[model samples]
Target: MKKILRLTRHALLREQDAELRRIFGSDLEIIQVSETVPDVARVLAIIEEHRPDVVEVILPHSLTAALTRAGLVIPIIRAITRRVLHEDGTKDAPFSHYERIISLEIVSERL
Candidate 1:
């Protein structure tokens, strides 16, 4: 059994919850938090409480900045869809702190 902190918009949470339930059954304990930038503190608090093995951030803008600043204590797995493409065509550097980075394509293919 493992815990996962899900940082996503409340609107998206429902779908995510359903999907997670289907995939993990009862093996995952998810703590869903706000996806807005201003709610970073609350999300951080949830992270501290759960101390999940992985923090799954949905929205790149809000979560990435907050996660970077919070000094996330656990591994992170971001569900990125569009690659972070730079102006010169090289992909932007993926956040390095996470043990893994899960792309939306991968999730879709698997699920």
Candidate 2:
């Protein structure tokens, strides 16, 4: 059987979902959640409910800090953005192109 992955983002975009699906392919089940700002409890609840192989969280730094302070055991991938800025400081690429995944464990270790 294929593995299941859970992805949670601040604003769930259809294009992001499609990109993820394309990357993972049909062999993996990708469960997505969209919330403006998901608290640690809500994130934990989702993990408990889904029991996914890995949980990818695309949230702001503040919330990610809270999650780290909460000390969650489940593996988490922090989805970062690498955007190209225009002369006016506007983003030049789509959201998909800016996504960069990093493990929470690695993030914590650096601290």
Candidate 3:
């Protein structure tokens, strides 16, 4: 099983987390850390404890670039979203990340 650490707490992320957990079943393991603190040490400790294969860093205020450049052996995924307004003025295309991330979430939910 692939281990994944999720770093996000936004409404969308939380929704995705729940949905993912519902979809993945058992192929993956998800560990989530808080977004309140940007402390690298604390985050690193959580990552160390989980020992995840990937750390999904979602919308980190100022630490995204730094963490990405830290050169950690574990793969770090940065989640980005695009807010698009429809012709009728409705928001669309809310949460946007790599398809793999979506797949991972779906897989985890199933498990």
Candidate 4:
């Protein structure tokens, strides 16, 4: 089983749910967070409470900068995406174009 802590809007979470289902299969847990920009304290609280194996930061917003300063060691999967606009000027997706997936290992080399 896998634990995933996702930071994304509730309304714009369908994409993530589908992705997670394909990635982690049916043996995974997803904890949804509505914070556009989550501070260290809030992140820490969630981690401590749920003990998620990894945190999926969809809307990173200010999380990267804040986490860098705090120097927390954890597995963070960052989703980089761009909003898509249809030809008729319609927004069909919350976001599209799976640009790149960044895997950040917040840890120092163990010597």
Candidate 5:
């Protein structure tokens, strides 16, 4: 069986589960985790323990740098979500646009 380690809590990646299953096989062991501000030791520990063939993660710059320094090359796949809202305070207007929220960056990344 193929083993996968999911390091984020977001459901966006679940949209590809069927395709992933088809590619990997019928049966898979998926381990899911959502960690905020994981230290280098903790990161390596989880990887060593799970020993997954695939790991889906979104880590902060510090953690990423630490991993890079620890001689690991990680591939990244980020889920980008867009919400369109009208300038007049409704989403139904013709001038619908996306507004950036500084607060959601951390929450989104963690998820």
Candidate 6:
């Protein structure tokens, strides 16, 4: 049996949320989180509760800083808005629509 990766997303709007669902499909168990910015405590609490394999946050600079300061070990992914495909239909791009802020292995090392 394949391992089910649990991913928690924070502050994603309707379109981004739909994109995530479309991209990840059933492979990931996606959890939606609406918390943002100064509410690091609430985000931390959600992390503790869900214990997700990965946490995806939109515009995460502040939250990332707080998580780092607090020494939380979960991996974080930063979701950014960008066209999924170019006008030429080429997939090569400087950055994906979303990017992982930290890798799971890196998080494990920190832990």
What C-alpha lDDT values do all the predictions have?
0.60, 0.59, 0.62, 0.61, 0.58, 0.55
1-111: candidate 1 lDDT, tens digit per residue = 777777776343345555555645668777777646456676677777778877877654545555666666566665433458888889864332332442223122444
Q: Give lDDT tens digits, candidate 6, residues 2-91.
A: 121223333445665555566556455666655443567877777788777666655345556666566656556665644567788876
Can you tell me which runs of candidate 4 are displaced by over 4 Å?
A: 11-15, 35-38, 68-73, 94-111
* Residue 46 lDDT, candidate 5, scale 0-100: 84
What TM-scores do the predictions have?
Answer: 0.47, 0.54, 0.61, 0.60, 0.56, 0.50
lDDT of 5: 0.58
Whole-model lDDT, model 1: 0.60
Off by over 4 Å in 5: 73-111
Candidate 3 wrongly placed segments (more than 4 Å): 11-26, 59-61, 99-111
In the range 1-111, model 2's lDDT, one tens digit per residue, is 234444454554566556655655656666666655447777677677878765677666656666666755555564445578889877764464324333233254443
lDDT of 5 by residue, 1-111 (tens): 878676676553444576557656769887877776459788778878888776656577566555556654433233344566767887631212222112212223553
- lDDT ranking, best first: 3, 4, 1, 2, 5, 6
- Model 3 TM-score? 0.61
lDDT tens digits, residues 4-105, model 4?
777666443567567766766778887777675546677767667777877765545456546545544556665545677899998754544232233334
Candidate 5: deviation at residue 80, Å?
A: 5.7
Query: What root-mean-square deviation over C-alphas does model 1 reach?
Result: 12.0
CA deviation > 4 Å runs, candidate 2: 1-26, 86-90, 94-111
